[model samples]
Target: MQENTGAGYPGDAGVTDDFALAGVPDAFQRLWTPHRMAYIKGGQHQFKNENDCPFCVGPGRTDEEALIVYRGRTCYVVLNLFPYNPGHLLVCPYRHIPDYTDLTLEETAEFADLTQTGMRVLRKVSNAAGFNLGMNQGVVGGAGISAHLHQHIVPRWGGDGNFFPIIAQTKAITQTLDEVRQQVADAWPGETDAE
Candidate 1:
């Protein structure tokens, strides 16, 4: 048996020169996002009913309060509270319908219109190189809020995917939601042709 020296390995004689952790060197710099704990703890996505849904309540609030980028007659564009990347937006119908096929003819038209407008605005504001646009259908399909049908508009840059997301399972968002919301809202076109 060896005595625990407290400063180093049990066999070492209080010599921690080689094992010091305080000054260890590494290539990565941490970007602490304590705000994400809420989302992780289910504060943001868990809703008991449609009345408590963020998408349903968002239309009643001010644009800034709800982080809304653009509003159409039947659909609207809002920033994802928990975004996969910066400038990520969601185009949703005002109605709290779960599936895409549930959309009315007018809602469907406006939904498509808003999605195109979202892509255009993202390109104009953030110079997005490409996009990942889709909807996760239900809980089994990776939809965090499956009760609301929202199409994601994720802006992709050339090298946005780095070692962090793959190795550490952490995505570093460069902009605050408020900042993104304001920029997207300000850059939104006054009118988009709806079909």
Candidate 2:
């Protein structure tokens, strides 16, 4: 707290000194301020609007319209809209349910099958040697879309992680989403199976 002159005492909160002590450059600090203000509070998320919810009616609407891999009776696979890698995909159920408990037995089975198929397709498309399969069961952990449950199959390569994500918060770069979608969709179940 900065010393307040005798007329009236107002706290300084130490914000300026804290940043200065930490050696944050003035040019870098000014550059980051505008980016912080860009968020629109209370904006409707894409999934919240059912009319435009891609996981529900969007997959069945068209083969090319949605990037769905296999449309099962209860669930389907779609390329991630924003992905960590080229072939990143998520297996989501038709019903907008949040957790594993909400999914029916058939829905669960379909998700499992699609996850396996997605991994296989990723391996072939990206020539990836390994995959990191995971899910966020609920909020308070990692479920960004807590109202809709899904599984991610992230294709891994030898040097996928360099210093960017760790040091500068910069992500590893990627190919276009359309190209990645085309590659995965083209290698449908009927296409090829590695022995």
- Clash totals in order: 0, 0
Q: What is the C-alpha lDDT of each candidate?
A: 0.84, 0.71
Give lDDT tens digits, candidate 2, residues 148-190.
7888888889878565654575676578777787878888576
Model 2, residue pairs in steric clash? none
TM-score of each: 0.73, 0.68
**Residue lDDT tens for model 1, 83-188:** 8889999999988889999999999998998888889989988999999999988766767677889999999999886768656768899889999999999888
The regions of model 1 sitting more than 4 angstroms off are 1-48, 192-195
Give the per-residue Cα lDDT of candidate 1 at 77.
Answer: 96
